[model samples]
Target: MQLIQLNLKHCRAAQDLLMQTVRERGSEVAILSEPYRTGNSQGWATDRTGKAALWLCGIGAQQMCDIKAADGFVRANVCGTWLYSCYLASSLSLESFGRILDELSIDLRGHCNAVVGGDFNAWAIE
Candidate 1:
């Protein structure tokens, strides 16, 4: 399964770029962070070919698990695996970060397989 992680910066062109990436790379799943959500992005789950669907958080019920949406995370369960698409705030304090971790741990309870993906805002200095 091909997964593409993109940071849109809330740009309109980024949507087109996302589609292009999907086409060129044959991506099955897209983990978009900071996507430009003007209206409801609920329809974005489906590809042009209708071969795949995007299970956004809080939009609707997915296959096996109920998708949940929070301030910085969207989580869903596929079969038995938990998938989390998250965006961490850059200005978060140490205490706040720890709190988020605690909350996430609680959410992940009872799930054996879990995948977390998104723009973590961690820059690598060359």
Candidate 2:
């Protein structure tokens, strides 16, 4: 029942660190960021924003582990109105992004335990 939150900053070394933590703590649950927005095929299994979170079942939970591990992972697109100079000219719309979230939440609920990790792109005041 241990939970750890990490901001991986898109470093490969961080994955190694996570594995170490899992070994030491017998941790079955973990969350990591894939900052570069690379897909899982690009040597990284990450969310749409290049961030990813992982959860592992602790020792002696073979049955639980046998279930899909992806069930415990969640990814949310946090890219909000704060557009960088590079994206300023892009045609992506924030309103469309919001719709995606609304649609995704429905399907995602059936997949995993009630936990969410990844860049929310949400401001504290918002």
Candidate 3:
């Protein structure tokens, strides 16, 4: 299965771009973060594949905690699963991001195949 992950800036253009990318790639699963509103909003419609999932990390400080509290940090165990997780971050930082990943690793308990895709506001060199 193909998993497409993106961090939308909550712009109409970004949303359009994400949709266009999904269409072009024929993605079987898509995960998006931020910018995408929740509940009864057009943002939810972007998941055209129906196979897609949205992770709306709340805004500001809550967003930071949300990321740290996410349980779907590892993707191996989350792939092909219908479970969708979203975390929002107010400021992107290495330490903060790493902590979130650490939490995720703990949450997944070393499982790394379940996740499909979503915006992880971290840069790791592997």
RMSD of each: 7.3, 9.8, 10.1
Each model's lDDT: 0.59, 0.41, 0.45
Segments in model 2 whose C-alpha atoms lie over 4 Å from true places: 35-50, 53-57, 62-92, 108-113, 123-126
Model 2 lDDT tens row, 1-126: 564556666677776676688789776445554433333321223333233444342554321122122221344222111101001112336675456456546545554444454444443336
TM-score of 2: 0.49
lDDT of candidate 3 over 1-126, digit per residue (tens) = 555677665667887776677778766444665544434531232232222245322221211111122332322122224434444253647676667666655665543344535555454559
Deviation from truth (RMSD, Å), model 3: 10.1
Best by TM-score: 1
In terms of lDDT, the poorest run of 10 residues in model 3 is: 59-68
Which residue runs of candidate 3 sit more than 4 Å off their true CA positions?
38-99, 110-112, 116-126
Per-model TM-score, in order, reads: 0.68, 0.49, 0.48
Rank candidates by lDDT, best first.
1, 3, 2
Score residue 43 of candidate 3 by CA lDDT.
26
